[model samples]
Target chain A: MILRTLRLHRFKWLLLTGYLPLSLLAAALVGDPVRWEDVHWLDVFGEGGGALMVLTWSLLILGSRPAGTVSNLLFIGLSLILVTLWQDNLDEFWTIPDAQLWDTWLENIPMPVGMAVLTLGLVRWYEEQRVLMAQLSQRERFMREHRSIDPVTRLASADYLNQQLAIELRRARRECSPVSLMMLDLDGFDLINRRFGAHEGDRLLQAVTELLLLNLRDGDLLCRYAADRFAIMLPQTSEAMADLIASELTSAIRHFAYRSSKEGERVTVTASAGVALALSASPEELMQRANRALSEAKQTGSGCHAMAG
Target chain B: MQWRDDSLEATWRSPDTPHLPAHHHPALLIELAHARGIPEHRLLRHTGLFPEDMRRGEAMLSDRQYRRLIGNILEYDTGGELALVWGRQSLPGHYGPPSTQIHNAPNLAEALNCLHHWRHQLSPLLTPLWWHNRQWCYLLWTTAGAGRRGPFLVPAAMAAVYGLARHRLARSLDWHFLFAAPRPTSPQPYEVNLGPTVRFGAGVDMVVLPVEDLYEPWPGRSQTAFTAAAHEAERVPALNGAGPTLPEVVYQSLAAHPETPAGLDDTAGALGLSPSSLKRHLRDYDSRFQALYDEVRLHHSLYLHQVMGLSMEGIAERLSHGDRANFRRSFRRWTGLSPAQYQRLLPE
Candidate 1:
């Protein structure tokens, strides 16, 4: 089945390149026997160009779409119309024998029939596409607003944290309230990756991010800092409250059991957390203090919590 | 778990694992090996299948290959009732004949009765009929011992049975059908093969036979065959064994200790049965033990992840996994989503 799909995709590209050139060559070889002036060349060019524009528009719709029912129908319809147009264009060059009245009917009647069918199919296709696009747009909007989110974990990144910090800092200053920051670093994360594969380690990080998000207050903001570190911003909270939250976060990480995929081996993961007060201090200063406290916690060993002095 | 019979272990370790006899059916071969304590891999290898091929459970082995493998296993297993157990497990499409007969029957009621009687010829994992509005009717049947095989096996088997039954009926009747299940995400072969309206996670498998066809007469002698097939099917034991069996001992042990190295042979030996016998026994119960273990583990893991609100890393830890990625894949298989997506499904 996988091979068949690959072949289908391959054939689509092959047909695009191979058929266009072959069709053009056939048209060139079957050049007009009558002088170019004898036939209605201008009318042929105008009609052909109009058909090409319609065909190009349909092809664009097909190209921009993901494989789906409406796209497939549109593609089939476009192919039929294109085939009919090709036959119509062929009449400008070659004159069939007198006995072949069927070719003349095929050349003239099929194009209009094909065009009508294509137009009908496209209307249905457009309606279907609109519905799908609406649903897709919701997801797209979510993704766009959360572009700074880690796709694998759906957690905010460091850049998001910085932006949120700036916005919240202004709000806190305006409201005349305190906001605090917490930094958490998973201890021995490198050792974890070394023991298990790096993939498992990444999973551990993702899980940790989720855990932090779950534990955060409604107004709190969380972000992934480094590979194994995270930062959280607590609004309308004091240093004492941040200290309590940081301790809870540290306990959660300490209790976390990271599992291995290849073999179901469970390894306990611990984290060291640091809390710093945001008492009218700049974001950078608060961040620096939190980092310092985090370093202190790490130095103190596994599952340690440190508060800015 | 101590190895009860050293000879069975020897056979498993031996280079030339016993193969199924030529005349034996594929279902019988599976039953025999499962009954005798022969590992699926050993039987599969003797049939010219590599260990890797066993992983692809959905891939159908030809009847010829199935027969050859069973023949080899029967060659070496002489002392046990494993062959009988194997026979019970190996019955192909326990519903194959009856399903076909049912389709040929004139009326839906007759067809339903035919199915009810003959369903036992296959594995007993399914209950052929259930009480619906005070009348006995074909409804959902749960596969026992499913945990031992793999999480996907029972669902897959259920799908195959429905598909096969639908194909047989389609041959005789011009009617549309739909399958409702929760796991299947896309509609391709399922739609084409089972008829449109393939809904997933629908809670159960059911056939809404055309209401008009309820009073139609049997087309041929399908009614007689269905009755005879049902009686014969009753004598055919459930895939695993006789009587009410507990969850395979290995599953309990593994559930108790998910991190333990409870491979196929280890669990079989622990249960005082051969691996082949255990597998066959599981089939009768409408399950395989290995699959059960995985299911239990996954269920527990998911419970911890969602209900207990455990972190993925923490859940992985309890499962004895060293990493979360492996947990994510296993969880996805269990619930058709990554851990993050599953978390999203939970109410805030």
Candidate 2:
């Protein structure tokens, strides 16, 4: 993945490489080799270390991020800072002519200028993250772990749900608030796979995830608990309120007209949900209760069932 | 003389015997992975086969080749749902008249009987053996040279059976699943596909169902179609090709005389073979009589202790262990944990 990203920034890589020769020529033209006694090993160590760290940061940004405004800005600012630090480290080895102050200006000017550009890049990055966080609100709660995201549905996986449930339960306990979990499963999902194919089934899951996210409140978190089953974590929700939300979710999915991309046939599905409100039960027990209630709902052909702990 | 045919069956055909039709399980698996965007070559890599092999009119896969195919698919599988999904699509599948026989059964009980009777054709990997007590019926899954692929194959086979049962009944039946394997990191597939009443790390792999549920008539039963399908199925040879493998036969004999604890000589005599011949036949399937015996004994002791609610001393006495201490020692050796520790690992 990193190699692919780096391949996309060939021009940026060329610019980064050009810095080496440019700095070398500038230092060699107007500077004399310093005496061995005059060399400050301590200063070289500090400045060289800073330059190396900044280079690493720039490479990481180039490798992980797309060639967007934020990445370009961050890359440019770090490169500038790295160039200045490289100049400072070079001064310990080369003694510049007294009349030539360009080397001194090179060390002094770019550092502060780079700081300003870096600040601007950080500000833009913060704004970009806010928009992404809003979009991911349904998938994640207070934590973000990329590994926990499901590849097919782009939703948090069951492991993430377990971790978030633990935190939510603890917070609810301390704050004396109710936290409810609703387990939702699409009815006869296997039939859909058998009819169309698993690819269509995966697309249907992604569409259903979107539909569920649309119906959820701002604070509600939706996770893909497993294949064809999803879990919603609702804080400060009572059992009655949970049942209401569960029914809304069921009705939303029931009405969704998912078109199969292969055949373009309109396939509709209903969902069964089981809601459980936390009292003092452990997270595992609470999840079990919700899953059992889901089984009950499925058996009885109910839209939703609530179990109060 | 009685053992001549059995011994010959074992020696002539090993795990390398081409028992499974390429179009059935192998094709179904390839289709599933292909739908999920996995290329056919990747799923068939190192399995010494090609996508075209499945299309050949009468291509077949030996147990070793099928195991390799399963291992390859599992390498690309995440979250462990592939096997369950495969199982769901497996049964009532197009093989021959047996699929029709299973599909046209009168009830879940008859459908299950068809699966058991035609297992050599339908489920060649694991042999399904069922028996019922007064209240509940137990469907036991015994391996037939599954080797290292047992874990993956069992769930898929179980899911196939469970999925068919649900489809026939149009509702989830009240059943409890027991697996002799450890619990997976994610149990959602097992719970979602097979319902939530599942237990792992049990001493046996089986499913327990209420006897009443078994006899409940499915809505789509057609007596004429069922009888016709059965009559047609009889003309087709058992898909295991040669016959029952040695491991399955050994498992049956050991399971039949669980309390008596048959010695190698006794079992060999029962099968009409000398002890060395029986031993060599089992080795062909990558199995041993002692391993099969230990498995049966372990299943019996755990069942008595956990399911039947027998105490340690009572179980030891029933199994003919002289004392609780010897039973404890044997149990530890079998499961790597004391009986109490094993129980602790079990789900409530």
TM-score of each: 0.31, 0.79
DockQ of each: 0.01, 0.32
lDDT on C-alpha atoms for all candidate structures: 0.53, 0.78
Question: Which lDDT tens digits does candidate 1 get at residues A1-309?
Answer: 344443434545466557556765655564445566677788689668866876676656655665656555566566656666766666676655646665566556756666676777778877886786454331222223455554434566565666667777887888988778888877766456445534576677778777776677666777665456677888789777888898898888778776677787888888888888764677767777887788778678889999989
- Candidate 1 ranges beyond 4 A from true positions: A1-156, A197-199, A214-221, A235-244, A277-282, A299-301, B1-348
Q: Name the runs in model 2 displaced over 4 angstroms.
A: A14-59, A79-119, A302-309, B1-8, B15-23, B27-45, B49-61, B72-80, B95-98, B117-124, B182-185, B221-246, B249-289, B298-348
Name the candidate that leads on DockQ: 2
Worst 10 residues of 2 chain A by lDDT: A300-309
- Compared with the true structure, the alpha-carbon lDDT of candidate 1 equals 0.53
CA lDDT for candidate 2: 0.78
True contacts kept of each: 0.00, 0.41
